[model samples]
Target chain A: MWRKVLTFGVLVVFAASFLLAAPVTIHFWHAMNGPLGAMVQKLVSEFNQTHTNIVVKADYAGSYSETLSKTIAAVKGGNPPDLVQIYDIGTQMMIDSGVIVPIQKFIDQDKTFDVNTLIPQVRGYYTVGGKLYSMPFNSSNPVIYYNKTLFEKAGLNPNDPPTTWEGFKEVAKKLTVKNADGKTVQYGFTSGLVGWFFEQYMAVQNALMFNNENGRAGRATKSAFDSPAGLRVFNFWNDMVQSGVMINGGPGWDNANGIFASQKAAMLLDSTSDVGMMLRQAKEGHFELGVMALPHPAGVPYGGVIIGGASIWMINTHNTMKEKAAWEFLKWLEQTEQQVQWSEGTGYFPINKNSLTKMMYQGFYAKHPQYLTTVFQLLMSNVTPATRGGLTGVFPKVRATIEQALSKTFDHAMTPAQALKWAQDQADSAIAEYNSLY
Target chain B: MPRKYVPYVLLIPTFVIIGLFIYYPAVMTFQKALYKISPFGNRSFFVGLRNFENLFNSPSYSQEAFTTLIFVVASIAIGLTISLLFSLLLNEKVPGVGIFRTIVFSPYAVSPAIAGTLWSFLLNPVVGYVSYTLLRIFGIHSEWLTSYPLALIAVMVATIWQNLGFNIIFFLSGLQGIPNSYYEAAKIDGAGAVTRFFKITLPLLSPITFYLAIMDVVFTMFTSFGIIDIMTQGGPGNTTTTLIYRLYRDGFIYFNSGMASAESIVLILVMAVITFIYFKFVQRTVHYR
Candidate 1:
């Protein structure tokens, strides 16, 4: 009996060792939580199915910040993952680190790997100094999400959505309902504290937010948005917050979506990627939903939202085989068919221009024409560096500065000018501190 | 020699683990502090105290440092006092005291993230029943996180509530260990309840109090980032950007590993000095039996 047990144990150990050596598992860390996480798992399963040599093990790594932290820790520990999904804000830092194997380099090695077919705006974001470091995976932009039910209930035309800033305010004023006790029953609008969205608003007005090629060419030398025009936008937002027409809830994108889904708020400014979740929730609650271009100051057609989403990058800290495998996966992801599939699964815009015209995408666009608006917006966007996503090593910290300043203003601790000045000063100091290191 | 070596052998595992996991990383972290290191690739360049120089000059660091102090001081002081008071009350033979003790200590079992989420819901403007009730009753509809004074208060409240249970359990155990003979003697001396507490109970409990104080201070300072991350995310415009939170932002968000390393070293030094000062001065006042 003892001899038989010993033989079984040996076999088990040998089997485990063989399995461990079967194929190197590529660790793919991402911040796709909830339904998006499930979708990512399915995609990985498909990848593993098609490519038996490289087993892609996709793991959820909390939010964007947490994933970045874990990746950095793993890198320090000499156990970095093969692939990582990093937000656009972290591009400069990742590029400066020189640890990421530029996808451009990898693609160049493989002639079949072509990136020229992708949309210029999408490719341009990942491309630094004309070399793409990553493949755009889940690109999104902010758009106006409104509750059509609320618009109709307020005796306004639901079809004609707010087109301009002033129009947005007038519609919001009508939609905002007060109770018998004079308490606001329904808020007309809610926008979270996001500098990017505000930047988009300014962009529509053909205004500059920063200098030194908007930190695209190099490190930002100065921030130029501290102008009277910029202050006017903030002032208008502040007035809305004070008037109870809009709420200044800090990064309440989820909250605003919930409110809009439940017909509590008339409109919400949020990311396009959230359409899947919002649509599902709206369907469940039977709420009438509508979409429009984010309100710019009426006459400004130049206001285009910069992309906001994660892009997959191959970390070079891994072994050679793992790097090659990661490169293969990224190339596969860039394919038009795969891009279309991914966009269909999530509400994210397809990076490949061809994917936009794919038959399946055509059917989706036919049913939801508003979903196709993002593609048009990107196409029409001014190719100026300012209209491109803002670049800074500490962009997340800069966003927090906006959050902090807006929150203070919302709490009435400081006026719009005071908050803006403080935020700019704080952001400038943070930028300078970050620049000193590099 | 063998007998002496037996004791050394017992200590070896702990020392090895600490040296490898804690001390080694700490040393490397200190070294990394003196350079410009990014996570992706090129080895950091030696910048010679430049990161520290820049940190002190930055408003974010200064503000975060100050806010960290506020968070640590407020959380520890308030948490200790309320927990101590609750411990004393639960120590008494009151009605359903056992159940009360269990309930008070229950929140300690919850993760800080869970606590933050629950508190956020409870304090949310539109949906939070607690805040809604408070507004209706008081005629004040202030944003708890928006109001700067109230924002820290909200953080402190969550920190205190989440941590009170752990401190209560500690104080309760300490209270139970107290000799009944001391109380009997006080009773014989016709000492009032308050007098007996101050004279007999307070002096004797000083050792546990000192331990709890040190533990609480360290725990509060180190772990405040979790609550801040979850509850406020150092928001309302950097009102709650604690030291550790800023460390997280600098390291992870900005990907400035060098500066993060420097900030961490500064944090370690600050914690070490504070601990040393406590042992030097406050420990003398402990009056352990």
Candidate 2:
């Protein structure tokens, strides 16, 4: 009698456990770190708790560069994860790889999901030829962050920052301070010399960076950065450097951020995502911080800040059930509450339109006015062909080429036109290589 | 299995590992050089010698070749000279010989990437203490990483510093094997230290010097990837990009496998010819006891 009862209990326990075991687990690789990574973990855990039928495992890949490189290796190795977060610059390459499923297909098969709810400018970056390729996640724009205390010390208005390039130069000249030995103790302005600034400044002037309407109508065959507007931007920057008001800060973002945080520079041009970081650094250093949109020429009417950040893409090289589970997780991620939580936690502008209406978000933004500047900048953007962003399969490489050009002109005494002409040639060749392959 | 085949059987594991990790990829690299491959390794097409032709005809080829030549030759020369100096001093009858040997050989334990990062931080104009002192004392603002020539020089310094310890050890061991009777005889014959070093010690150390020279050249040519990657990344206008770095950039960063493979083939041919020349020239001059 004892033996029979024990066998029955064991069989029942095994059967119940087998029946309750979760279905396929979705592996997601992303590049979020620090507070943003923690927020992503929280969201994934919440989804796991709500959906008892499936489990989602989130892994933090290093940076966008590392993540994309690893994802390419994973795809070629035939062991791809269910989802990956790729930067917007990688959209063309992602599509060319043919490793991802169009999120539109999932939206088409599902009746509840709506693609129209996405913010237009944010959505436009990930779309190609009338098809949405990836889900927009973190999006930001370049903004001018200034030391409020320094502005007051320089006798400029603390509340009003320059919105035009010429006016900005004038204010920057006033803000620049030098020691008795004629060595500059504080530069008037410093900007990150990465390729994104060129892209953003071009968008602010309403100029296209690549041919074929910024490559939305068709594939880009060449880069258009050596045009008249580009020449103007380069010449303006060259004059700033020559005048001893602006520091090049080299080509890395960390160097520029260091220059700004250490109070060696009165003003800095950087990403909107860094608003929270900049404020935190200022608080630690006891400096007042202010924010404004990036400056272009006088006539463009704040033409616009272009979107900059990574987006999430679903790789469908797995089984059908896994893809379904991944799609469900993505849908849950796109919820209004989740979007607000992400934006508030990470200072990335909200990708969802309805998320702006939430009382919690409003309260948070009221407390942090610096973050609101990004929202207004995005709202006021004109969404021109230039602002939609340059789409080429070799954008990452092209950006490297352009940054090299910036270095040559900024540090090596090369003329702006000469550096830009060399960049144009290199970019054209790179684009040709990419186009031939695809 | 025959009894005579047992030794062959014992060697099978090593052979398999070498074949799998070394020979197989080498063969595949040669094969892949003839084709244009997609990102996913699907839809490959043969393009013959076009990849090679394009690489040679490209405008950046001359700069890359010159940079590689300068980096390899300069690093090998610097490594051998410094290591030889240190080894000679350490091989003396000085006190704390063991500690001095350890001190001289300690840097070899550091990985190339760490060394590169350390030197980069130390050489940074804004934050580096070395640069700060130089500016304060002498008013010399050396752009260690910004200017193309200075950046290549920085990379070479880092590479030579990291490789010096290994060469020192080889030269030290070579010094230990030499009989002391000849040195005493030279001293008795009224030969000065410099004359004794050149006539007696150098000839005795020829075999070791030959070995180290060939190895230093090969290591600088092929194994300086990590230093180049961290310090300069072949930049300021491709001034620090060596041939190996170029191969990796084209293959991985640009996703052009055919050209990378063609570059790899060229690298192999260059290395093979270098080794042939090195052996033909240096082996004849080496004197064994």
Candidate 3:
């Protein structure tokens, strides 16, 4: 009887070990914070619950730049997370790093997964040399979010927003409000001194930012945006600031949003990712918000917008089990249902093409029409190399130079031509240096 | 273990820690300054002083150096003067002195980033409380964080505010250490308050002042990154981009580690020279006894 009992106990222990199968734990570092972070957590927990043999430990890894820096350090220290969310500008740097395994490898190996299900424009940005390096996660494009209430008060049609540079200026002048003292109480437009917006403006004018087909065909050795298209953008921005119809929202996203939310400014130029937050802000501020496509220069065909936001990349951890688990999580995130959920949760539009046809998305769009505007704007965009955006390891440096030029131009310290020229020179040198190194 | 080597044995952990964390990194930084490292540091080649040459020749480096000079000098001069005054005031025997001292020293408890955030909201051009009040009362609207000079001034203001408590604490201690008998003796000798302050107080406080000046220089040079980052991000045409902030941008953001390493070396040299100048020239005026 004692022998039988001991054998039973050993059998029970073996059954428990086999049934449990110690789930593979994969670390994921993301830059999403606030509401977006919550959604990521929710999705991660859902994935964990569904996949019995896998557990994803998600970490909020500061901002995009911080996340990239931390990931690089971790990779060098030989303990990088299995997956990391990198911003759009970091794509070239990641590709040059040569530390990541292209997600295309997994896509090709998995028989059930279809790469075509991903949105073309979204996927195009992450694709280099005919191979997708990362999975397109939270993709966005810039749009004009205007105060409809302010527009109506200014005697303009609330339904129709500006579509051209000239029109935007005219609208800005009309929307600006001032008292008898001539001190302006409200400005017509404001935007953060973000470099992404300048890139989008260049794209909408069908202009490449860097040489060698916007750095897609080959390594970029020089900046290409100092041309007429670039000047047009700079001149327009300068005109607004000089006319006193626009407020310098400083730099970064929050201040500009503050200016808009406080009703000090009537319109804001920001990423489409702010749709969810902007809608809530409008409600709290007792104003109606209007969304429109980014304006192009008059008489120039719209080239569309480059995708902003970030994508998730799988690092080469040399552990096949962990790699497989990370790929499974990525595939699950791109499903139509999950994409719809992510889109509804965050203002970032869905990257999965089939998410648009889903009933959930249709309902979401019906409730929040602003989201549809962003989606349609992306869909209508021309699939040009310019729209696909520039690629360079020195994008952050180039962006900084452009922002400085913008600041100089706006403050009348330099003419738009001179500022763009200086920016072009600085960008060229940075790119040249990066190319020489890598 | 011999008795003579006991102290050395006891210090082994400290030496090992410093060697691993501090000395090793410093040596690595010096070595890296001579090499052109790739973004992820996977590829590197010896460039041999080219990074330093490139930095010196760069247009922005001179501007950054100028900005750094202004930031350090102004922060030290202005911050020390104000802190000295506050410390002197709080040194007096008065009701609620403890509470006042605590209130005056509260800012030191706030982290630089939090202090910067607070100041950012206060100075924001559109909806900031300070800006709104200024506009409402005087109709003067200044872009505090976006304009060139104003952005630097804003960062300096936040930094000084955050560091005031620390400066005050040191000054207060120095002030307390001064004997009241000195002031009484000066009064008996027909010395006026101003004369007494200059003749006795100033001379006696020189040592602390000298130490503070050096500390303030190092603090402004190295630790103002958080304030500048949160405030202007070295923007408005890089008006606020000091050497340290520029180092961070080059290394972490631009991934030009070689240039960053060179900048770090220059920073170390700058610090060393300043310290030498203090000990050689400025130390003559300090009255330790």
Q: List iRMS (one decimal) for every candidate.
A: 2.6, 2.4, 1.0
For residue B177, model 3's alpha carbon misses the true position, in angstroms, by 0.9
Deviation in Å, model 1, residue B22 alpha carbon = 1.9
| Per-residue lDDT of model 3, residues A42-115, tens digit only | 99999999998999999999999999999988988989999999999999999989889999999889989999
- TM-score of each predicted structure versus truth: 0.89, 0.90, 0.96
A best-first ranking of the candidates according to their TM-score comes to 3, 2, 1
Better of 2 and 3 by TM-score: 3
Candidate 3 Cα errors over 4 Å, as ranges: A1-20, A359-362, B277-287
Give the lowest summed-lDDT range of ten residues in model 3 chain B: B280-289
TM-score of chain A of each: 0.90, 0.94, 0.95
**Per-prediction RMSD in angstroms?**
5.0, 3.6, 2.7
* Candidate 1: tens digits of C-alpha lDDT, residues B244-279: 888887777667678889899988898899889788
Q: Put down candidate 3 lDDT per residue, B1-289, tens digits, no spaces.
A: 4999999999999999999999999999999999999889998999898998998998889999999999999988999999999998998999999999999999989888898889888988989998899889998988999997899999998888888998989888998889999999999999998999899888888889888888888889999998998888898889999999999999888878889999999998998898897888677866568
lDDT of 1 by residue, A1-438 (tens): 999999999999999998867876789999998878888888888888999888998899988878877877787678888899988788877776556788887767888866788888777777777788888899988888888777888899989987778998999999888776777767898766676677777666656666676777767856666777578777878888888898655554554555566666778888889777777776887777777777677654554567789898788864787888888787777777777777878888888767888834469887876677656677777666756667777677777677777777777889989988987887787777667656
What is candidate 3's DockQ? 0.75
lDDT of each: 0.78, 0.83, 0.91
Error of 3 at B151 (Å): 1.3
